[model samples]
Target: MTAAVAQSLSSLLQRTTIEDHEAVLKSCNAVLAKSKSDTRAQHVKAVALLKLDRYEDCLRVFEDAGDALKQSAGLEYAYALYKCGKPEDAITIVSQLGAGRGAQHLEAQAAYRAERFHRTAEIYEDLREEHVSMSNEENDLRINSWAADAQLQWKGQSDSVHHTKATRDDLEAFETAFNAACLSLAKGEFGQAEILLTRAKELCRTSEDLTAEDKEAELVPILVQQLYVLNKQGKQAEAQALLEEISISNISDLSTKKITQNNVILTQQTSPNPYVLYKALNASPTPVDNDKLFEFQNNILVGNTHTADLLVRKYDGIIRSTSKALSQSPCPSVSPSVNLLAVYNAAAHAQGQTGALALKAICPLLERRPKDLGLALTAVQLYASTGNTTAAIHTLEAFLRGLEESISEDDKDARFNPGLLSVLVSLYKREGRTAHIRSELAKAAAHWRDRSEPCISLLQAAGTSLLHSSDRADLEMAGTLFRSLHQRQADDLFATAGYVASQAVINYASIENQVDQLPSVSDLVADVDVDALEQTGILPSPGSVAAAAAVIAGARGKRPAAPGDEKSAKRVRKSRLPKEYDPAKTPDPERWLPLRDRSTYRPKGRKGKQRAADRMQGGVVSEKVEEVATTVKSSGGGGGGGQKKKKKGKR
Candidate 1:
């Protein structure tokens, strides 16, 4: 080798050893400048790029260096894929690197991202058996094992995640508690979950190695998980108060931002309006996309219409490639393009990108799968997302009408997909088509026959909507629906609330209608049959019945109360004086006041501290401070004594 290349190789070794990635990059570049085929230079340069977190650049260098990227760089490659949200690809890459501590850890991490919770647990288990001693890695393995179990859903073996926690190093401890908290939360031990998350936050805050950015990145997720626990515990005030301590503005890192957003949505706070909660969440965000949709969304966000249009066609190619395979898959949710649609729609909304932008992606697939309810709903969402609600509603209605006539058994169940029905119902509601909602929900209620949760929910919704009507028939129907729902699901507060409201409306209407049928004051004497009342025992006796005719005749002394008089009773002004009050004598001071407001009312409420001297009701005289306290208490004097009955001063 030449002297210059030799010097460069020496410098690269020195810099690489000390982990000065930038310096290592320069030294590697120096060697590669002198001899283009220097493999060491290429490898060191790639390592520098990976260490700097220039993943794309590192990948490019890996491509150029071939096998020189080595095991660690291969691990970095998998991590880069994981970060890019291609967990399956990450797992594939990690699997290709054979097995070891790093490879197994990488595979487990990738599996976690892919939501292969069981696989993650298995990998952690293997690692645990091999290590056999306490270390940071062991803590991490234990934490992640529990974390994976948390998401194993029905397959989870145990709920004793809280007992698994043990002392660990700062970052390892934070991660442990954070993961354990997830298991706790999954088990519905929200109080325990909250404690774990708080512990995680403390570790993050006190971590010596982490920078402010790092602390914030770790701390925000802990706070967000804590917020979720608070919500689950119904401590809404504490959740809102918790929001104040988070500073999303300081979180410039996209991964952290994504974490925050995920937690915010997962928490499911009451408000549907994300913008109102944007700052409060410290995480409320427009859904972000990976490279596929990001290219299109970024173009739209920056007003690059021409590029966005060109990029929009990319979805067409993706649809053409994946739609057939994905349609055959059992789970529609796993469709890549369909899954990305939400992120695409959200990104477009944030930029106010209103148009039929979904046409490129949805049109071809929709045309091919015209009768597919999932596809049809996706099409509707596409139109709706692009600010074409009218088109969306029309599209949905046509699909529903067709499915209503289809001969296939699957079609029958497909039409009843709760999400599909919900979208249609919500669409109709938005358009203010009360009749449509009533018809649709009524059909769904009959179809499910209260055998399903969706049926019960739709029934309650239908009942609530019908309860708004003033018609007696509608009110009665609503009451019936609510009554049935209350019977079927007694614990459903919403159903119970709806039943109460509907019953109230029905009862009120009945009372009002009865009042409406009653005779008016002018017709009261003509309408009364005194002899009939006497025979029916409604009158006092036969003599009274004979007198009843005369009784009702002059019964209107000045004004007589008739049917529905209570409704109009407000027209009468009550006199403060009693009927026998003499004008010469003054009236009782509190006669005009309400019974509760009268001075004679002695309110019983929470007790306050009483002095020892005051506790002695015999009015014991005291000395010094006790005497002063007594004097002060007496000065305030008694209350509720009808304005302290005082003799009028002589004029």
Candidate 2:
């Protein structure tokens, strides 16, 4: 053992100890390059190559190392060969490693990786049975973990295997099912994954030593996967329902009496399942017990649900105790999250049961903490559902004002603002405040044009309000707004077109009084189809008397007479006559003269008096009366003989 030889031996031992194969390989290669005849260095280099995942290089290095320790290095060579897809060669080498448990395990892993699942299972079973009496429990657990991992991998790789058997109580079975479910999920086989996960959950349910953390880790994955599966199946309502159930179960179990208070807070702080908190807050059997809260928080954090119902009862008791404790020595200051959590729980429970008083009780708490976005949102929702638009709007405005002041330019709050904007629009609509509604819509559109929900909703609100507005300018503004929005949101075409048509009607009305100032009827008609007008039931039918009157009145620029006017009254009565009755064809107009004297026709009412005074003020009225008498005498020819006989009698 000279200095250089001793250094070489030490270097070889250090290379073998290095976990990183590439580093080991590099170091071993350096040693091999310096000592070409060192067979031991060559063997170490081959093992390094094997670990580095370069199987062919490992084989070359092993062959060049010579046959001095081939039996001992054979297992490593076989594994490297197996990984390189040379399973036949791996099998031949592994078969010669003798009947040791380590050899069997290696062979099993190789068979599992090669897709020979049944053979791998047999090997693992034999290893387990042989190692049952072994004192190394940790080794057994590791072997079981490996076998389960392999089984899960196998199940995932092949879907043709029937999985009807109930999962065994062994941890290995659950591990296999979990891994298989995960693999199936990754491959978009949600149905198979869900079944496997459900089985895994059933297996873990009865495990006595399962800790809160373990339960949490175990169940969270399954629930998340279940959610994914249910959502993919288009069973959204069912998924939501399942989420609710899981939340309730988690809260009940975690809040058991046995859970420590510190553990409760820790669990509440770190738990990924917020739904449990949500459920606990909303659970029935009012006035949440402290014990129940404690248990709920614990179980939720831990993922235990074996005795959820009992835990829920215990939770009720704990809540009562905690409330008494808090009352005895009230903390003057609590974290905002804690207060908000309390309010959230209360509000959620109130909302679930339609407990209006309970909801109102939490409002002050929520109002005081407007910074809590979740609390604010839930409050708005609950108020809105109850038709308390005022309260809802107030809560929403508080949130918006807070956000506007606090949210920064780089914050992600911009993505969430549109939803709040939509809620504002809904509130205004519910209040029938068209002006506020339009303003909110415009603001929303400016901010949320890319978000289809808010954009479409705002456009609809604006278009509807504009359609019903009397102002031409407003209608035109609405039309322009709708047209711009329509390009982006084609689904709102019907509403957009209605707004445009409304603007057209307003334009038509404006021009009605100044026919010369407006486009001609034909031109206007060309721009707007009469059929559309008819379909909308806004314009009268073509050629109808009403239509004629509209056109005549429109053309003359004369306002139609009021109904109380004598001439308008007469026209209205005459207009009601059948088409066959022609006033122009009357033989003697005076033959149907009034039986009473002209004094009888004297004005009686204020309107009639005004008409007579105007007639008297105008000399044409007296001349028209004389003309009517002279025309009547000319029509009476028999009057001439009566006049001649009267003249003879006088002579």
Candidate 3:
């Protein structure tokens, strides 16, 4: 292919990303159309195909491009093989490309896939100094992941050679200490690693016969480790001393190395620093080391009055120190500017300047990193703390809107972070701007209905906040929000509980208002017709009308007058008992009747008449008396002492 076609194809490829696989393929095909025999065009086509995930077609394209272009297209070809499930072949292909960054990355990936972690580490280490630089945050993240994996696999395998090498010279000592420190750092033993690296520095300093070249070569690694440790230990002055010692020629190189190491720490997502300096200072008035105080004064943190007090007491002027740090970095980078703003704001606030003064100082930094959530949140907080709540809210709103607008239409559903939304909602609630909060929350909730956890949590927090608000309308809105949340996520305990609580509050409020408006008991009962109410089912029917009547009558505290009770009524009115009344006397003649014969009625049968007759005679007849009489007669010969005796007996 001619230079023009090659340039066109290269320009096209430059504009393509993983998200535009079709565009890549189209551009590559257009190049291939003009240069059917061009191996470069064929290679581009294969790469585009690979990115498009047409693995078999990609491999075929590579094969058709012939073995001559394999050296040039090795990474793409190997990547295709890996995608096609031939990792061993991919590994072999990548290994044959000598010392290139792409080859090293590809080989590391292949080795990683093949579980050859040691080989992966070796490849990454080879790429560490040459083609790889740490300025690229994404690349840094990738390297850290690969390195962490390698470190995990190589854990507990500390070679004896490394120990022996540490005794040799400064560079050797530094390397040994760095390696051990890296491992120790990986395991979270910061103190032990600090001790080792500090010793490594001492060894470098006391080396007897080292040449200038050796010293220069060893200086960086020792400096890097020392600086990292000092930063970790919050020893900024010592770190500054080490920084001052670095030659300007090596500053870029040292920064790259530091970023690389810092990336490793970041991938663990742990803030390994002892304390967020500002937070520690804010929490107490305790004095920190000069190094830490320097960091705070230089705007690396939002220092408190405590830090200012310490700085004033020690160095005599914190504001002057911070301004000096700012002047030192005139063409300020993002990181330095962030620190500068933080310290400037903190110092100004300490001196009793309005929050607006501090905020104005950092407005440039805010504009530069509009999408930086941390910086944006910090600015919002500073604005809020200084009583400029409206400004804080507007800043957060702009930040969140920028984040939304920056997302591609394809990723708009998935990519939104809820943290900004949460901060904004919190600000709104703080300012009592509840009306804006719900609408913003609804938009966020709908956008993050399925993907983002932070958004969901924000909605939950907003709903809970609304539920507890003093306004009844806000509380009702809370029930609606939580009900929607519960419908979407039925198992969310907070949403479910919030919804229930809101409903309870609403019901209680309604009932309380009704209670205040209700009439007194007499007035209420006067309007009600009891018979009509029971018939209409508004009132329940009594289970026993007579018992209900009696209970009601007794509860009235007055006896109804009856014709027969006139005498008793007169006695009751007099508050005295009748003269003839006796406490223990029976009221009627039958009141003392025997238990077995109280009633005149008898159970029917022959026994009934007999029982009645016995009761009438006041005696009980027994069957045994009749049986004895009959037996005696029978024993005397049955018929009156015999028939002859019968006549005598009769007489």
Candidate 4:
């Protein structure tokens, strides 16, 4: 604690600034053991330990110095805390440092590590504002801004990447191109991703700004992404070849091993393995011919439609395609394999024809497999998708006639929840067929009213559908259903909304004495939290809840319309709907479906364009890979994080 001892400790720290870290650490420890009360000695020891990259041991030294070290040794202490997995602690220290890019950058990294992606993005955005209005740029500010945008996209938010225009030479900038490639891959634009990755590869090899050590950090990641894009494009052979060339030391982002395993599975193993050579007979437990279905599904995921069509033919052979397989399937004993459904659906979707027009593609299948629910449901889906609701309902009703229940607990093959039935209920709700729900589906609806999550979600969907009904009794019916569902689970978002909406409508119509039912709703508004509803992109904000309540209160003060004040129409009102067409004469599709699907029909112009955009919005992923595909590993901070230079390791 004396002047001489503190001066000696400062001299020991000076050795750390040179290449004498180990010697300084040894000397500082010796000095601190003798001068246990000297905070200056503790500071010197922390410096030497940090310089030696011993972050864990450095923490003990800093703990002794504590607040005394905050002013002078804050940067190194915070960096050490971040390196030692104390990012939140590092964030607090960074905040105390006040105003500097280094502190802000450290906090950004800490927030990213905490998985606070939105906060990480905000910090990067603040750093990038000066660069926003320019184009053809290759600076850290712009690059980190795009990187942060990619992180947000991975977190399932809409991407707000500030894409500066890229000149041709800009493609050779490895960092920019690499990030752009990830954005493309996430968007399901494999061809564009591949192009950007190729540019990234060229720049990794030749960028003059990089030194020998830096190239290694960037090489493996680019190659790994390339192998993935190639696999998605159905170039299995090329993906296998590229995967052989990639030698990662500690990488885990790309599913390199899984992709390689799939390639190995499909490489004509007929003699060694017969799984790929035959159509699976079993529908459950495991897909008997999973390898083929996996490959087929992968093709469908990337919209390699032509390849998927070829795969369907290759899977079942041309004669044993979906129609033929269903024809041979033993009805009621078991359904035709799901492999055929995938094959036929892909073939049908590629043609842009569903329902009966799609029937030309597989009419014989329906005739042959009359008892197969899978094929029947496929037909119903096609009918529904193409506005052939009349056909869908007719087909579904006839299919349900022989079955005793919508879900059979005794039959393993029978459904537990209603995907197939919900479609029907949806159709019924649309056509204002309250009798169909009341008289026909009452038992089935009661059966599924409390079964599982899927059942609950569909019931909510049904309630929402009825809430939009033109009939006042239907609104009351919807309100009753939603009230029961909300009471069961107060946190159920759609259930709560439906109950509040119904109460709002019913209260609006009631006289003052009937307003006692409003308190339950008032309590619900105070307690329920459905903020997640805003992210669905389907539901409007519940700001409408307050608006509806306000309107209802205002309406209570007004006089009701009398018979004399209710004027009759001077001219007969024309129907706002499209003129109904005859199905027998014009091949019109809507007559068979419940009215809702028909009402959604838009003439194929701007509606078609918007639908296409929505499909491609968050990137169209098929079901299976969606469970498996990971986004590009995000690193924190703006582009100033030193470029990871990956050398092409010994091939």
Top lDDT hit: 1
lDDT for 400 (candidate 1) = 74
Question: Where does the lowest 10-residue lDDT sum fall in candidate 2?
Answer: 287-296
**Prediction-by-prediction clash tally:** 0, 21, 3, 18
What TM-score goes with each of the models?
0.43, 0.30, 0.30, 0.41
lDDT of each: 0.63, 0.56, 0.59, 0.60
Candidate 1: Cα lDDT at 48:
81
Cα lDDT tens digits, model 1, 116-188, are 6667778888888885555567656666776777666323334222234445552357887787787677677
Query: Which ranges of candidate 2 are over 4 A from the true structure?
Result: 1-354, 384-389, 397-416, 427-436, 447-468, 479-651
In TM-score terms, candidate 4 sits at: 0.41
By lDDT, the candidates rank as 1, 4, 3, 2
| TM-score winner, 3 or 4 | 4
lDDT value, candidate 2, whole model: 0.56
Name the regions of candidate 3 deviating beyond 4 angstroms. Answer: 1-67, 71-219, 231-382, 398-416, 429-445, 449-651
The number of the candidate with the highest TM-score is 1
Instruction: lDDT winner between 3 and 4, please give it.
Output: 4
Clashes of 1: 0
- Superposed Cα deviation of residue 507, candidate 1 (Å): 63
Report the C-alpha lDDT of model 3 over 528-568, residue by residue, as the tens digit: 88877654434245557644554455456655444576454
